[model samples]
Target: MKITFLTVGKTEDAYLKEGIEKYVKRLKHYTKLELVELNELKNTKALTPEQQKAKEAEMILKKITPLDHVVLMDEKGTEYSSTRFAAYINKREISSSATLIFIIGGPYGFDSSVYQRANDKISLSRMTFSHQMVRLFFVEQLYRAYTIMKGEPYHHE
Candidate 1:
């Protein structure tokens, strides 16, 4: 199965970009992975938080196809251990041929429309992290999950 890591805005920090790129390269050995960075909205001085989210939702929804399995990286979503997350990825790999899209919404979180389109929701942690930081963390965790799936030495209990 192909995996898509979709996020809003560019990751500006050099360190974060380097970290994300490292895992993305490693992930290529296991599965096809796509890293899509949507353009952030311009000139948002007038828009309220809700409005900004609504605009972001529109951009996000456009990237998804009907057959894609969309999962939102949300704070309120199910929390899983690394092993469990590995199992989850393995399950999806075994069960589906569709592209698995994992989305990290904009600052105010996902709008109702985006939420409605999601097939699942996963929480990286209860504590919040910066959106840019979440990109690197998610990719690293994904690499870890694959290693766990392969019974590699990269992950430990």
Candidate 2:
């Protein structure tokens, strides 16, 4: 199965970019992984938070199809240990879907429509991090999950 990380906005920090790249490369060994970065919305000074989310939702929805299993990286979502996350991935792999799409929405968070469209939601931690930094953290966890699934030594208890 192919796992895709779809996020709104770019990773500007060079350090984060390098780290994300490293994990993405490592993930390639287990499955097809792709990171899709959408351009940030322009002229947001006038738009309200809900308006921003609605606009961002449109862009996010356009990228997803009914065939793709969509998972949102949400703050209120379920938190799992590293091994449990591997099991989550393994469960999806056994399903019929060809692609598993994970999304990280913009600063205002996801709209109602985006939340409605999601099949599941996952939380990285109780603490919040910048959206750019989440990219690095998520990818590294993804790499760890894959390694755990394969009984590789990259992950430890």
The top-ranked prediction according to lDDT is 1
Per-residue accuracy of model 1 over 1-157 as CA lDDT, tens digit each: 9999999999999999999999999999999999999999998989999999999999999999999999999999999999999999999999884999999999999999999999999999999999999999999999999999999999988
Whole-model lDDT values for every prediction: 0.95, 0.94
For model 2, what is the alpha-carbon lDDT of residue 6?
97
> Candidate 2 lDDT, tens digit per residue, 17-60?
99999988888889999889999999999999999999999999
Error in Å for residue 137 of model 1: 0.6
Q: Which ten residues in a row have the lowest lDDT in candidate 1?
A: 91-100
For each candidate, give its TM-score against the true structure: 0.98, 0.98
Runs in model 1 lying further than 4 Å from the true structure: none
TM-score, prediction 2: 0.98
> Model 2: runs farther than 4 Å from truth?
none
Model 1 — TM-score against the truth?
Answer: 0.98
